[model samples]
Target: MSDQTTQRHPNILFILADNLGYGELGVYGGGPLRGAPTPHIDGLAAEGLRLTNMNMEPQCTPSRSSMLTGRHAIRSGTYAVPLGGVPEGLTQWEITLPKLLSDAGYATALYGKWHLGRDDGRLPNDQGFDEWYGIPRTTHETTWLTSPGYAPELVRPQHIMEGRKGEPSRELQVYDMQERRVIDAEITRRTVAFMEERARGHQPFYLFTSLTQPHFPTLPHPRFAGSTGKGDWADMLAEMDHNVGEMLAAIDRLGLRENTIVIFTSDNGAEFIKPWEGWAGPWRGAYFTALEGGLRVPFILRWPGQVPPGLTSDELVHGVDLFTTLATIAGVAIPQDRPIDGVNQCDLFQGTSAKSGRDGLLVWVDNRLQAVKWRNFKAHFYQQDTMMSPPEKLPVPFIIDLYTNPREEEGKRASGWVLEPMLKMVQAFEASLVEHPAIPMGTPDPYEPPRRCP
Candidate 1:
């Protein structure tokens, strides 16, 4: 924002919404249309920079891993959400964003879902967060308690857990349907308290408030149930907005608005499951697919005096970019020992340049190269319209110009010229893999990447 402001690290409050669709927000053209009015979230867009073409990995674990590590999930061995019973998550060798920030003397905490890992040494506290309090896995696990034929003795129930760095994470309670409904509220409350406490100190803080809402079993809090008059979906959406507004109000009340960077985004596109499905705005497909609907999600950043207000950019931005961008903003140096896929987007965020400093990225769905996006065009090697549908591997990669066909329905008619750049992008990534190599899935700790000399 200002030269003085740039001298000191600013507090970062990143609020991640699980399975929030692009068009679900009013600013993105789905609020009222979707029977949910997001006044506070809409106001966030007006107050800061919004990216229309923000992209993420097709699934929760991959997207979150990419964001935290600044590397593709394939490289981190978190390419997919593990069903359970495995040593899954980032290796201890991986330098996470919170770890980086914490190393720089910031108070770091995550007050929601920490799906990266569920066991010791891999939990949020062990991964650089000073403290963490949330579920070990997804919100849908809460359904396991109510689902028929579920045997608790066979599969240990998911718990609402908490931990401090250098300590074993302790289970707090069962994350059941009731806990699911009120978890977001608890996350918000802790987040607000974290901000208030950190504001009193000289050290800046990095608080990641991961709200588990509108995902599966999209239950609204008791206070918000029937508040929307539409259904549980609409009510949950309203609750999400209200929770956001509460945090924004806290920032203002504590006078941290000018010195804090507030970010709002989703883990993926939208939920595709029945009875709890989410709209992807104007796009087709949903999470777990390579289509725009699955890869593209809503992204809003509010840095009062630094980032330009009411600015919407269609230039490509990915969830991985958050790691590099925030590192730059906090004056932290990223690791150079490994390949980092995220590009520095400081200029784009500050509105200093129109380009996003990135032109394309490889699209992966569970360790498989599903597609490649370059500029406004994408080449899909596999087609899976929705999460429920089986992916069809095509003999020839289908291409689509997103500007003309956002729905990707006329991919057969796409120009052949786009194939060159798309393939080149894919080839470049594959080449990088040959040198640095991707970490194999379920890689154990005490890992060390091979070193190659020029």
Candidate 2:
């Protein structure tokens, strides 16, 4: 095929949900919940591939960083939430997905939350996204709810913004947390407009519509309020589902569905909020913990003819893999020198392979190495002193069977568990960690402590 014909790449649309879980959607067997149905998300799964064993970092920033850079979060030096401002954002050495796609003549834009970095040097414009409109920091808590008497300083700020189309300026706008009705609607409107504009343009585009709904403060638009019949959190999820439907509708109307690859996933698992049933379905624990519910997130990929409709795969994949897979689909070359922790799972999506493509996986939480999954077995490692101790000197590692027990329990043990593979994977992962140790917690480093606004 000629360069022009090869360059006629499929438009990529990645929709990310903050703190969404695997069992939250109807297609994931959450249909019996009292919430408003998620027909649109279910439709996407029915039309594409639903990955049953998708994993992410324990927190949002790290997971998103892994996705953007195709490397471990520690390698990017974005280990945890920023303290005050992001100094070392995504390393310039890292080749981001947008950068690769843009180089291949694809226009890229990010709408909604951007928790990766906040400083001008770390903004999306600096990190390969041609256009960005969302929170500079990780969450809205840093800007809106960080005040003394507001919610406990337990979470990061989750703000909102729009970039590349305004007056070449950046500013923060505050809104009532209870009144997300207006905010979400406006974001959807702007995102749809962006899609329509890109569809009319000469080049194919890659757009990331990151939603802040269903995160925390679990507030839904008034029109969707009580629509879920469950509670506040379910209502927020319903609103998020509606926004997704609107985006899909726009793609169909613009005559781009056939040539577009749409993916929907969450940064991590659910967080603490009312409607305890609103979050991760049938799984134990919420965010900030090293539980299956916290890391195993919802992953849906849709590519009309390329991906068989009504298909589900139990392959173990990570958010970071999307970078290489999309690059491969676009015929872009991924740099070989850098350390990228993701693989191209195009064959798995095609249903030709049952292999996970990954022999081992790593996860971090609050700047500490929390867990490692090797096939059916997983090991959990916790740091005694996150602020002072080196990761290698932390202590003995605990092992568990993810296939039998999703939760790491105290008394449960896998008898004569295959230690050779687990030990080898752990040594490899630890060797990589020594080269890039976990940033000590509670430090001035951007990846150590959670972002705190004064």
Candidate 3:
């Protein structure tokens, strides 16, 4: 067991950033935009594969739900980030990435943000993770709880919850700056420790190291503070890269490089709100919109012997596919009892194909449809100014030729051209509903209070 060389399926480590934009890494031209270079992250793209057409939902909760379950957020009842004491998150009907992998003898641990559910029945431990050590809500909770006139009950709900292999999950304390400032570093430390610990064991493992940096109140660790000289965003970005380097180094140190598969990506798109929030690459909108800037993000994967080095692919892969892809890699079948939106994308992982199994992606915010992307075309049926703003459904759908207008700055290019393909997409999506009916949006009723009263 100590050899680290006798493994069948490779160990997988999936790292997700909170509000990382597509343009913050060195490979994505963020080196010139942000202050410090993301050499460690960029080196990953150079060593493995950098996905140009990776698609996902535009918000954190939905995106994470889609990634964990091989299904759309609409099906899992976790369509958006619930706030203000709202009881919403992943329902028990859904199975998750860690649960599936754990069922097949793989040790699973979630070492960071677990925004899927809040209550006991809906949390990471209940969902499938073997151990959970991270925040239970969005990064905004800390700020919201600390704001003026904030309700006591509504504000201080989140904390550093820890779920170990033997003990039950419990709240450690109220999340504070003492924890928030070095949260990313702590996640890295735990992830490296887990990897080193597992290297001595016989069982292969799956670790989801979800870092909560670059979200709002972007605070860099003390060592990285002002080192970027760009701003809080720059400082945070550099700190995140340094943290990734530590975990990568641990894998190398334990001689787990060959059998380990490391993945780096963001929860959604970039944060485009603050001067220190960061840029969104060549796309429009950010974080919580239906545009490319919110959906299109960087996806990098490194596997020494399986995945080819220095390869780039422009295929259509969605975050929903993580469940199916890893299931295939682990020699386990995706759950056939339920409808799965993800496909076995290991072909693209191994450089065997230039295409993904998915031909289109659906953009859903809360319960309503916002956009539909088929092939090279993007069709928008809704719009929102910010995450807090209500999305307005348009009378006519706007179309964008993504190949020519990847930024989505142009308005309605050949609007009628989307009708046929959109109809086809709608038809296919509706067929899946026959078996697993789409769950209603999990937001509180209209009579219920808003998440935050302005």
| Maximum-TM-score candidate | 1
Tens digit of per-residue lDDT, candidate 1, span 1-454: 3435434989999999999888899999988887789999999989999999999998999999999999999988899998765687889999999999998888999999988988988999999999999998899988888788999997889999999999999999999998999999999999999988887765688999999988899999999999879999988989999999999999999888888999999999889888999998899988998888898899999998899999989999899999999999999999998889999999999999999889888889887899988898888898788777788899888888887888899524578798887788778888988988888778889889877886
Global lDDT scores for all candidate models: 0.90, 0.73, 0.81
**Candidate order by TM-score, highest to lowest?**
1, 3, 2
Candidate with more favorable, higher TM-score: 1 or 2: 1
Q: What TM-scores do the predictions have?
A: 0.97, 0.86, 0.93
- Judged by whole-model lDDT over C-alpha atoms, candidate 2 comes out at 0.73
Q: List candidate 2 segments past 4 Å from native.
A: 1-7, 32-34, 85-88, 138-159, 165-169, 175-179, 273-278, 383-396, 430-454
Model 2 lDDT-worst window of ten:
441-450
Write candidate 3's Cα lDDT for 85-189 as tens digits. 566787766778788788877888998898887767677887788888898886767776667888866545568898765456799977876678888888898
For model 3, the stretches where C-alpha displacement exceeds 4 angstroms are 1-6, 84-86, 151-157, 165-167, 441-454
Using lDDT as the measure, the top candidate is: 1
RMSD of each: 2.0, 6.0, 5.3
